[model samples]
Target: MNRKTFLKTSALASAGILSRPFITYANASKYRVALIGCGWWGTNILREAVASGVVEVVALCDVHEAQIDTCAKELNTWCTDKPKKFKDFRDCIKNAKPDLVINATPDHWHALIAIHALNNGCHVFLEKPIAHTLKEGTAIQKAARANNRICIVDFHRRYSPHNVSGMEFLKSGKVGRIQEVRAFVNYSGNGGKQKPSEPKPADMDWDMYCGPAKLIDYHSGIHPRAWRRQREFANGTLGDWAPHWFDQILWWTEEKAPKKIFSTSTKKIHDNIQTVPENQLVTYEFEDFICFWEHSINNTRPVQQGENVGAYFHGTEGTFHMGWHGGWTFYPHGKNATTIHEDPQLDLPDGQNIKLVWADFLNSIKTGELPHADIEHGRQATNMSLLGMLSNDLGRSIIWDHEKDMVTGDAEANKLLTRDYRGEWVYPS
Candidate 1:
């Protein structure tokens, strides 16, 4: 089929408008799939893949035995065959010989697993922010290119229908020349005091879980779900949520990376619950405009009235708010100009957009075309967040040379581009 026809068919399939499955192969063979890091979101991606009816999961890998068991039980209910389980990803990849590998590990493990899978001739579906650090992200991109493998980063907003329409509206100049962009998230229910570290659970292989990252004491607050708040394991809220918003801004502006970035962060909660900052403000400078990122852990008030977590496009003609589940709205500059609003077709249970993203990945694998959020795009978005975090850590603004992929004239800042891996877990080149 042609490009337009393919896109239309894919969209229709994603929206459940088509009567048949999104993919139908003439032969009986199905794509062999393996899932590493059987955590909450990882399993969610696996679910979409199984639901697609185009792939068979052959292996499940996780450092935690409980997680593997739980995921296996769910897969048993969804599929006819039981998948082999492994604690080591290398064994899973070698033994399962999967055509596609779904990587849902923490940010720290992203680079290692993705590069390994790509090198072993597997198309990778990697969860975002592409890696724990800037260099790691770049390495994953290189691995994909060098191996000539398909790599799709889980930046699901790129596939959202309302987001697609919003981009079309922005490109049409309805919002006029954009001057500044703001991305923010303000919510409650985090920050108080740190939870006490507990003895490691028997079901979890803590050493394997901390591969490549510093091995820290096991805390319930830092595992299973709350790892995002810990600096050792992940990049906190900015690293977790900013990739999606930064991705939206980059997609809308068609820019690769910001020229200069400055940020300030504060840990107001003064708790062990989270080592990362609770409040952060990052400013990114481009040639024509500026982009700002702000997030707060316990502030429930919306950034702009009803919108809690999303981006705002400030233009000469008007302002646009691209919300998560709240939808999109546009306000014109003139005194009597009527505001335009579009309600979101909510992706119930969250991560529903993964289905559409999965369809795109499958299509790309079949057509030999790049997926919607390719590894390069994922690297760019991941770098933006990493740059901001580096600036906040250094307590100053830093210039970035995107072409060279380095921080300009800042020795200390540049040194942080790639961190030293713990023990034998080598950092990807």
Candidate 2:
């Protein structure tokens, strides 16, 4: 089905009836699964997969042996069987031959790993901000379509109970026409000054970890969780956090992409150590409305007080704010209007709500239906953020021809749609 039809079906599914037949296999064997990346968030996804009790993890792959060992140890606590370990994802996919692959790798590695798994006939559970570049995201989406595989991006908020209710409320027209939206992530801490280059850890295959991205000198800060702040490896707070909120906007509005994007950023907080900006603001112009994305590492508090990382929708009647952790609140236009608030239901650990996503993934695999958080949606959300970054990098506003998937009137910006791959790693065509 096309996106519009699928969305309508999803809306009906949300209301009480499912448009498509949902198949369930009784007494069926568990699915064989393999996990790639094995980092902190990756391990969290793996934990959710194991918690479902319907999948057996057959293999684990990570460039860092220490990470693989750590994840394996944690898995031992949850499951009886110890999974085979591999330093290379190709080996894991070839040898273990899992029915499903959980690709929780870094932003840069997302496309290659997910496309490889999809081509190998394995359904994929991909982590969000789908890929490092726009072209790579498109390639992964194409691979999923070509392979006819179930590819679900880990946009867990789609499964959040309160978020679902919030969308229902928004659809009720209580908020009126939402003309402008503000998506932001403000935190008190800054990216610390870069540490001196260090020798590569013995357990890490640093070259492989860098993968398609340029391989720079090893530093402790660049490994584990710090890669998010590095430009070569990830897209800072905008790439890390904006996709979730941008995705919410896309889902609520049913908009494919923005018409134009402009961004400006500052790196004054850090000693020019990090390539990504410490404070940034991006503006995206859609046909009907506009969105502003901002991130400031030096902020003492959030713009909406309690909502440090969330989006605010401004409508004709009132405004609604969706907090990342706290529940949503709605405020009327009048001064005397009473505000409405809802407490979040924290049923799952860390408010992840990923188990619900995993259930959808498994169901999609069984029924051959597209998942709610499909790879195409993931690509759109990721592209929104990537365009913002591209605008900032080019230091100018970019007019985007969404149909053409290219920046209009700027050759330099258009060229940045895909980055040059390092070494023998070919860019996905």
Candidate 3:
């Protein structure tokens, strides 16, 4: 859709008192928060949000009531107040009227729920990858801007202590100027093969779960975890894991969109897999530096830091290695590498990094400052993944015009930037 059409559609959709009157904190210390998607990761985020004592999780929404009930039971132990539950996000938004909405839904549902929350005068804390496609990410950003709501894309790594320290160290001129960046995500499985389709469970609203994506028969592989393999539902490893490292890279380099990107991928390991790449390599060119990303489902080679997944930034004076699990090392140009700050050495335990991110989101709302992973930053990271996938599909480098938000002179590549929403869901345009 054109810019004019997009603005018109979104403006019309956001009509109502909910869109007109933004939520005002009004000097209150506690804000009402609603948690959406009671999945494995969502529950973790919810726990952190509640534990922080920053907000009360007043409402819960999930397509699976069983999951919501189980999570609500868990929440009661930590929070004295019982949270209202709903199977439908619309009902939760309409009735609860929360001040904040924490969205941990799958990639396809992100744009819809976030846009709805923004229109309903709620700040949003959306999980990473931002959206299933670039256009959807843009729309969510647009809604947040239009409604004057805070929408934080939780690319939690930006809040990592090691990364924060690394940024400070780099800015202190210890690493000189970074010229090249390399990121990796190598694992053992062949992405995950499709399982036999089966009937939906009685307690699960399968259609609601499949919102904004083509409805498919319930399958063992598609639920609980394996949805990353579906092209329609996800962007595979690129969308699942790339956002974290890519966002970190952008943060470290102080860069936005790449000037050009090229990628190649293969499903050589598992032909039976429906979608996603078994192995892929992508290269991104910027004005001053270049970045490389690689992912392999079959390869188990250890990275420089003796890990399978992480990122490395090569600079003129020294090289910095950042492990996804949280740690950083400095390899001087002519000397051996030294572990600058080990994550375990910090003694903060496993889950505190995520909590820090949650704290930052609440703090942002209070201070009126942008969170580290604000919507535009999230959009940039997500767009990098989307553009790389488009390059892989096109088998050529696609020049980008960030100012125009398009693939320069490549109509075919540009066409893949946005996707058609499924069912009753319509693109803002």
lDDT of 2 by residue, 1-429 (tens): 444544454443344311212223212438989999898888888876776657778899999999999998888776665689999999999999999999998899999999999999999999989999989998999999999999999998876767777877887899999989999888866556656788998989999999889988887777887888888989988999999999989989977999999999974656635678888999999999999999988874634556788889999999998876788889889989999888775434466767667777887887788988999889999999999999999898999998888888888998999999999899997
Native RMSD of candidate 2 (Å): 4.6
Better of 1 and 3 by TM-score: 1
| RMSD to the hidden true structure, all candidates | 2.5, 4.6, 8.6
> How would you order the candidates by TM-score, starting with the best?
1, 2, 3
Clashes of each: 1, 0, 0
Per-residue lDDT over 82-201 for candidate 1, one digit per residue giving the tens place of the 0 to 100 score: 679999999999999999999999989999999999999999999999999999999999999999899999888887778878878888899989989999988766644676778988
What is the lDDT for 233 in model 3?
Answer: 81
Stretches > 4 Å off in candidate 3:
1-29, 191-194, 271-274, 335-341, 344-352
Per-residue lDDT for 115-197 in model 3, tens only? 99999999999998898888888889899999988898877666555666666676678888888999888887754554567
- Local distance difference test, candidate 2: 0.85
Model 2 quality (TM-score)? 0.92
TM-score of each: 0.95, 0.92, 0.88
Most lDDT-accurate candidate: 1
What lDDT score is found at residue 271 in candidate 2? 60
